[model samples]
Target: MPPADIDIERATTDDLEAVADAWVRLARNQANHGSHVLADPNRETMLATLGAYQVDGGLLVARDRETVVGFASVTVERGSLALDCTRGLLSNLYVEPEYRGRGIGTALLEAAEDELRGRGVDICTLEAMAENESARRFYRQAGYDSFRIGFERTL
Candidate 1:
């Protein structure tokens, strides 16, 4: 099937439910390796989180017709080790499983980059599980170069 037509736009208050559902699906997919299971976030939490993104001017959504097919959230933060004064963090980037490999993720990332650029972000950064080679490859193709390795241990 041809890729579904996607429309990228700013997420509104009314999009909270769809955004929350998308987050759940994406989180589950990301944690599919038996690493950990995340708790389902409540609608209020979703609203607050998205509200923060809006306040920071960093939320964008991709829609297929009236349904939200994908979304991304970018945040600007001060750089420590990097020479750049500020960098954009891809806090979240997700597309519905049915919508995967259909350019929706790419479009969402591009929209995020554009939004960050307009906000004076010099670099874009994101983290993917080391086991998720596909996500790593996608980011690499999207022009992201890994600068540091992350280590985590569960207590």
Candidate 2:
């Protein structure tokens, strides 16, 4: 599959539950790629979060005639009272393993970026699992350059 045929759109309220389910699968996929796992991710919580985000951000989904192939979650980062919201962050962009080569991820990402740009965002930022080489390559091809290094240790 090429990168020109995926159907991407903004998720509506009716798609809430389904989007929450997709978010869980995304977390699991990240875990599979050696990232941290959500031991008990709550669907209700995800729905509520996304619901609120629907007002402040935009949730995008990619589908192939009904089945959700992927989704992207984006929000304009609100700065302090002294600053403005000119930065957007793509918090998550996930595609199913089976749909990885079908252009779905690219579509979702592009849609989110466009959504942010429409809101006057000057820069878009996203974080990929350090262990997920595929994700790194994807963002790189999407024109993102590394600007930070994250570190942590068990306490």
lDDT by residue (46-139, candidate 1, tens digit) is 6678778866668788888889888898888765576636788988898887888888888888889888888888888898878888888999
Off by more than 4 A, model 2? 1-5, 37-39, 81-85
Model 2 lDDT tens row, 1-155:
22555678877787777788888887777787767768246667888988877656588878777776788889988866545447899987878788887677877888898999999898998998888898999999989999998987889
RMSD of 1: 3.0
- Indicate the worst ten consecutive residues by lDDT in candidate 1: 34-43
Highest-TM-score candidate? 2
TM-scores, one per candidate: 0.85, 0.87
